[model samples]
Target: MRGGDLVVRVLKYLVSVAFLALPLAAQADELQEAPAPDAAAPVPSSSDTILVTATRLAIPVDQVPASLTVLDKPAIDRAQDIGVTELLLRTPGISISRNGGYGTTTALRIRGAESEQTVVVIDGVKLNDPSASSGGYNFANLLAGDASRIEVLRGPQSILWGSQAIGGVVNVVTALPAKTLEGSFDVEAGSHETVSARAAIGGKTGPLAWRLGGQAFTTDGISALAPAFGGKEADGYINRNVSGRAVIELAPGISADLRGYYASSQTEIDASTADSLEYSLNREFVGYAGINLDLLDGRFRNRIGYTYTDTDRDNFNPTRARAQTFDAAGHNRRLEYQGAFAIAEGWTLLAGAENERSRFRSASPPAALATPVPAPVRGGADITSFYGQLSAQPIGGLTLNAGLRHDDHDRFGGKWLFAAGGVLNLPTGTVLRASYGEGFKAPTLYQLFSEYGVASLAPERAKGWEAGAEQHLFDDKLVFGATWFQRKTRDQIIFNSCAATSTDALCFVPGNATTRRQGYYANVSRAEAHGIEAAAALKLGSFQLDGNYSWTVAEDRSPGANFGKWLPRRPRDTANGSVSYAWPFGLTTGAAIRWSGKTFDNAANTTVLDAYTLVDLRAEYALSPSLRLIGRVENLFDETYSTAIRYNALGRVFYAGLRGRF
Candidate 1:
């Protein structure tokens, strides 16, 4: 049978299974609807910190059955990182590859999963661009500014998030207003003629709270390509961003929220060689409106929201006399409802429904020839999904979570996903956790109906499992954790060369194309990724030490000639360590080191990137009660490293800044 026929059969079976399980789930839910009874409070063995992404509800971070990390404002400030990429690089089980310096394409891989497989949420808005070659968020222009916190959830998380969550989820929460009226400003000057300025004002008055912030940054960066690649000119980048948020109490137990963000950038990049002059202008926008209601005297909580996102990119090759160029835009609109109810003592049920519509358009302007611009490729798709999760603490020191989701896509019919996990508190500050999850990614519009598109392709699928243990010592001041995880993916999409007789719907050669290759997207057989992550943290007096190490083996296990080969751009080993001290005299100092082992740049492992290590230092001093001075040196050793072949990495650089609040 053909691939299309097989997909239809599997989809039918999946649909039947999903329907069969719903009644059983409904019955189970009914049993939990008994009268609420007071249950004995469970003893807390883990930290009290909370994370919202683990189950779409606030819960203790350490109690989560999967490995995760949280970075608060203080931690982010002390890190002294300029961009999101730098901030996430210190995290365990994460690796990064940048084509050039700031503002260039930067890709992140978590636990051996590809960049596009990870989901990014900024203030409740998804940032993935459906029009891009690979459907993922571009981290190049995402400068860190006024962020309250960041949460990284590793492993599959499709039960809460809809799609493209095979790797994990990264949630960025922007700063919000405090109870007291306060405002702050920051200005910085650095190497490479870089300059940055940021300011924010926020306050809470009565039952209303509001915050407004803006940031501007510019830099004359290093050549994107190495000297050998004919790069002799420096690329420059500039970014401007503004955001606002407001929340108002509507009733005794109700609240309303409104938020919006806008960011734009103009970046110069090298195309093919250093001699080429290419530039791109990109803009992003996100808007959200939501309402929250509390019922049953706080026993049940519900939130309904609407989100809209727009991403646009325009690229120009100025070197060409005619300034050849192309532009694309993508829009995503979503409506969602979430509810968390205390079904019974020691048990909570979380459920939600999401309806999303995505649209894309792309066009290439006519060149020097007196020709007309071609019509844009336009397409749209919709996905309707319903999901539910149950968290139970039937006994002391034990927690269990189970979730399921059913998604109905306009083009591909329906599919179901499942995830389950548990955490057990052991004796004397020890905890054990285990989790298993399944994920799926629907085909993007460009892959489904555009040129070289395949409408018959099925969604890519993944299954992941992890187990870990943690120990707390010294009155919970010091902690250590170790986790092992593995994931397997099937039916990955890849482009293949096609011949004249090819009957595939996606195979085609345009009249204006330069190459003779006609290609189409096809499903690759299989791949596997497994890894070990270990972390430790110690706090003594005014000093703190933190470190982590990861060993990843991402291989192409497909049934083909490249089987058993190393996956491109995934390093076998990565490690990070940091130490900091705060003096009684309002002075703080920190130092950190990051290292990455060798990695392959190609599927066949022919091209390689050697291992390299970098050292960074940061210091801060309180000049006054509400004033501070900060300085940092990145790449102290000026080590030469290549995350991507022939791409130059930033060397030793210095930066100094001042911040004040009123």
Candidate 2:
């Protein structure tokens, strides 16, 4: 389709969706503003809400023009999910493709963006693996053990977050101590012999606060490959993780904080051709230390921090002469200084400077131990960045924000970026927002210096804009929102295959340009994506309803055989809906449904992947003020589906657990 035609069609579709929201909102317009059915599930009002990820500062949600979703502890608990990625699927404009079951490779995408373009941040530390081809963080090992908050910022966000923010950012904040002494725990067991246990203890003293948490999970999972596609044995998974946080007040206006997270996992995997006795061991660690200083009567706040992340991965085949098949490690060290100041009565400033160093080592061993393994492949990169944003409320109910950033890469040189946005809040319970952002991502170490790498590849760049509106009715009992966004990316990186008969220089051996090779990395791709997201939440007396729907059109605009074709593995339409009832007593029951549209498995759009839907039922009963009994059945209908072609997805499963908060 032509670009102009596509835009017009998207606009019309958005208008229709916007109008559809009106009737949905009106259905619950009669709901009186009574006391919340569940105190823990209070209604949210963006006008008075504080969002921290918009600019790395606590600003009112109504002042931020970006499209975002916030899931707090209460919401997290209500979902009864064990994986962070699963919980995020409840939000708008998001999709994921997992190789098999839990503990397998998982890639998360936001608004049809490449999975590698999404940056994952945990406790102020960025998570990425330089050894990986895309250098993106894997979500398989990340579980919802002790997460207290999760926020997703959609669309281009590089103005604040440096690289890998082309798709967006997922910031996860764990628990912080609130009482002098407190603890929490959750444990569950279910089908496939799956079991998950978690525990945490924390305390806040006179001048210090500390918390530590741990979780262990195991599952006798389904076959890695679908039964219809091939025969396979049951593949199991095991994971253990620990996280901690500590804060100390050294003086009246000075403080220090430390945070750490570690996870180790073993997952059984299958070769593309057949099932095997191979397994992968992965370990991830993150550490951060920061000092905070408050000045000018708390008007100015400053923080200096250092963060480190390490990821180690290994694969083994018990049947082979040599147990180890592969080994790789990636490390990142970063230092940053950030400041937020209330410059004036209605103006605020957010600024930061960051320096990051990344390194990687990788190797694959032979089956025979006696045969010496090749030396590991090693590489590194450095990036220095400076950024600032100005937020002003020049008049009542009006907010304008603008930001600028510059990044200097040791290999890619320097690049400048700018973003601007505005928000208008009306007394009639309406919010209008518009934003434009630019994103940049340097080539990964593997993409730059590996055997398949090209030294002259250019960095990927993206430009995007979004406009949306949110409407609240009946005293926050009914809320509806819709957003339309468009993004264009250039010089996107992709692997290029070389024909055996072709004479491309990049397809030859290092010393012999005539010797044909397999493939090489190149910057010959361009893409365009446009989407619309709609969300609604309604609370009527003891019953609550929530739903989100998204329509995305992502296509390759490059000059090639795949031009104008849908991007691989991205569904064009997806929706999530749920309904819950809160009893007068201490009992709650809910049901959720998720539907994903069909998609292509390759860039050429020849391979088709069928669409599927899943249903889940959940119930929770409060035994005491500090404890709750929870039970849930996922994939309730025993639906057959596939997120990735030929890869098996989880089936029906049951779990019951107890949640304690003390």
Candidate lDDT scores, in order, read 0.82, 0.85
Q: Give the per-residue lDDT digits (tens) of candidate 1, residues 466-576.
A: 999999898778999999999999988877878877665445444434443367677875789998999999999989999999999999988888999998999999999
Any runs in candidate 1 off by more than 4 Å, and if so which?
Answer: 1-48, 498-506, 509-517
256: Cα error in model 2, Å: 0.6
Q: Candidate 2 residues 1-662, lDDT tens each?
A: 23244335434543443354345334542322211111011123334554455347755567778999888888999999999999999999999998889988999999999999998989878889999999999999999988887888898999888898999989888887778998999989999999999999999999998999999999989888777789379889999999998989999878888999999999999875678889999999999988877654455566767789999999999999998999999999887777666655566767777788899988889999789999988898888777888888899999999999989888888999999999999999999999999998899998887778777888999999999999989988999999999999999999999888877888986667767768999998999999999999999998999999999999999997889999999999999999999898999999999999999988999999899999999999999999999999999999988888788889899999899989
What's every prediction's RMSD, in angstroms? 6.4, 10.7
Candidate 2 Cα misplacement greater than 4 A, ranges: 1-50, 368-371, 511-516
Per-model TM-score, in order, reads 0.91, 0.92
Clashes of each: 0, 0
